[model samples]
Target: MLSPRRLAATAALLAALTAGVLALLVTAGLITFGAAAVTVAFLVTLAALAFLVLIVRRLDGKAHRIDLRIKKYEAELARTTTALKNIETRLDLLVQAVEDSAARRADDLGAILASLGEDRVNAMARAREVEELRAEVRALARDSV
Candidate 1:
């Protein structure tokens, strides 16, 4: 596509040519006097229009550059999001592993507690037997007294 600047430049060149031709025609006494003045005025207005077109073209170039930068940022955001998701996935797996390990440890602790209870019962039975033996010895001592 033709840039606005190029379009405006072409329009200005055409206008200049038109003016020159009309002036030549007027000098040559072909066009009437009043018509040449109007023609020149119209041709002169082309310069402002040309300037406007140039400004638009400059804006267009900047817009294109900005659009490219935006696309680059968008791609970077997508990549970052994907990496975050991957990290989250790894974290979830780690949490699950920890939970599983904790559950197994709890089961092991329960078994240890059960074994301790059995040991406590056995110790209590031994303590009762010892107390009975001591009572027998005291009874013999009393009989001797």
Candidate 2:
């Protein structure tokens, strides 16, 4: 397929050749001046129509290519959207797992602190009992003396 510029140039050349032939026939006294002029006008009109058809066809082809590109882009966008959704779902699951582990660790720490508190109370009670035993021994020694 010829480019629009080349097609226009070819049309213009054809129109010019036809007009030159008509003008020569008029000069030779073969056709009247008015008839020659009308013939030349008709030939130029035909050439103009051909040029317009070529331009319209070229524009249509470009439009088809653009439509194909648009469809391809739309498909790619859909795939990207689906991938993003999957990633979001995985991230949500990971966050939930981390939160659950943290809750378990916190519970374990609380139990350990409670056990330490009980141990401290038991130690205090033993210290008081030892003090009472020591006082009783001293009282017995005084009576023996």
Q: Best-fitting candidate, measured by TM-score? A: 2
The digit string of per-residue lDDT tens for model 2 on 100-145 reads 9999999999999898888888878887888888889899989999
Estimate the TM-score for candidate 2: 0.80
- Cα RMSD, model 1: 5.1
lDDT of 1 by residue, 35-86 (tens): 9988777757766776777788889989999999999999999999999999
Q: Which lDDT values do the candidates have, in the order given? A: 0.88, 0.88
Poorest 10 consecutive residues by lDDT, candidate 2: 3-12
Q: Cα lDDT for residue 62, model 2?
A: 92
Report lDDT (Cα) of residue 52, candidate 2: 82
**Distance (Å) between predicted and true CA of 118, model 2?**
2.4
